[model samples]
Target: MHYCPYCGSLVIEEEKYCMKCGKELPSDFDERVTSSKSKWKWWKYPIIISLVIALFITVLFVRTQQQENDAQELYQQAEEMALIGDYQTSKEYIEQALDHKNNFPTAKAVLDFLKIAIESKNTINDIDALAKNQNYEEALDKLTAIENNISGFKGDLINKLNTTVSDYRNNILYQQAEHKLTNDLSKDELKELLWEVEEITDEKAEVIKEAIQEKIVAHTSNHATELLKENQFNQAMLVVEDGLIYAEESEQLQSLKTTVEKEKIAFETAQEERIEQALTIYEQEDEINRNQAVEVLNVNASVSTNEITVTGEIKSVATVPINSILVSYQLKNNDTQILENDVYVFPETLYPDEKGKFEFTHFNKEIKNNDLTAEVTKITWFID
Candidate 1:
């Protein structure tokens, strides 16, 4: 195969100018190609058709031998180009070798390999830029893509390319993981890096893995402790679980897990006792309020997009008129108590067999209380 004198890019024998550089080719260059291929003289062709026919079989054999030699020589040139990392030129040479002898398995393998090699080199360069920017995940994804692209083709360049790619991938993983693990990262971020490097069994990777494990234990333990202090038992337990995932055998994490469980149980027990005491007090107050001969009745509540309205009537069951009344109420949402407050019914007075109406409304964008209830807890009144 011919190449451009100016640019070293592929060119054809018949072209007067280089396609890549647009420079005029040497005129003798065309003459050399012509002289090489045209061995039959025009004057000799006029000798006899009979003589030409007689020599056809012998000439055909010699020309086939010469073509085979040319094919082998071109294949050698392709191999040399590949060795020097000029993959584009290597591919061109091997392709021309195949054109000289299309069925050459060795040349075909080299050509396929060169194409993949060139592509991988370009992709690796892009990965370098990405790694420089600390775009580690994207670089890792590209590494996977290149490995998959190799597709197990057989060639002399295959083992060399595989080794190069594998080394590059490992270096990327190691350097990035080391940098991240050495710095402060969230539990989730460290876990991601740990998972990425799990496939690497080398000693440098192990050091990184160890750093990640230590960080998980320390960071997660502290995080969980803060959550536990805030009385967020479930959230604390989740943080503990996150630590345990990376360092299942870590004594710190295991002890922390046990502490979380014990504290959660203890907290639950204390809460249960508090709730029980509160309920007992509520029931006693409710009984006392019921005996006082005042009762809440005809309670109705409605909710709008921005407001919750509760309106109810209060009745006096006593034999006398009552005035200056204030009632304590429990506000509930979805059967769970939310708040408590005191309100005075309108008119502040109810005669025997008479009633007073009360209403409460709250407007807040954040409260989506679709199922709200207002229940009376305590009532104070003066008999008149």
Candidate 2:
């Protein structure tokens, strides 16, 4: 038997060419032949199995990730519902999806939203209870709070609140008007008149919030006036501020604010002037006392045609031990200052037991107004 090396087939021994490959083999073909057995290692089967296992793991991991994403989407929807006050249904949805998902952010968010919603619901209930008992301020405060706390309120509720506020404001106005109308009308007759006016005014106020202009402004302005009368200018200003919030651009309110500001300025100016006048009087009195307390070293100076001399003495009894003191005298035009003199007492120390005198001579200039005044400055005392 013979085999063709190219095609690996058997042939007759006498054949010169291979029957399967149609190629001629050399007579020494055995020397050139090598083994045709498979060279694949045995561990290749394990490598193939590992590739298959890795593909299976990859598919499973992707499926788990998809499921987790779906769960997170459901939890987000549940939280949004809870925030809008749909707690029961939101809780139901979250609980249903909780088992399928781990690390659910919306689960915690939903719980927190539900807690806030429930608390707000309780607060509204409390307000309702108070409102039933006619505790209007507390009820109104809570209603305003609910408006702030809730993200959105129904249009119906908002309209209802508007009507309620209108009614409350009109009721207050009617009561005030009734107090002012001191006529002897029958109770039914007076009540009917005020009721009709309130209905018309409230209807107008619904269309225009500033329709209650006179009442809102007059009330606040009157209060401000009372404050001004009581000399409480700061409080009066606060009253005007509160009034303007309701009737912000009302001409009446503006006028009232202007009036209050003017009054406040006038009051402040008068107070300042009074204080200044008192200080001036006190300074004059202090100067008089100082001059009287000083020891008279000399009085009455000789006046020549060209010069005049004046002498003064300072006693140490009421003065600190000062090295020197300065005295200033002034000359004035009608109401304006024209000239001044600063006379320094120099080279002398005034102790408590000692006294000192000085003489000053100054030339006189003819002027229309001549008023002489003296004051002291830079009276430094040494710390013993």
User: What pairs collide in candidate 1?
Assistant: none
Candidate 1, residue 272: CA error in Å? 8.5
* Pairs that collide, model 2: none
Model 1: how far residue 315 lies from native, Å: 32
Per-residue error for 120 in candidate 2, Å, reads: 2.6
**lDDT tens digits by residue: candidate 1, 63-83:** 887888999999899888887
Q: Which candidate leads the pack in TM-score? A: 1
Please give the CA lDDT of all the candidate structures.
Answer: 0.79, 0.58
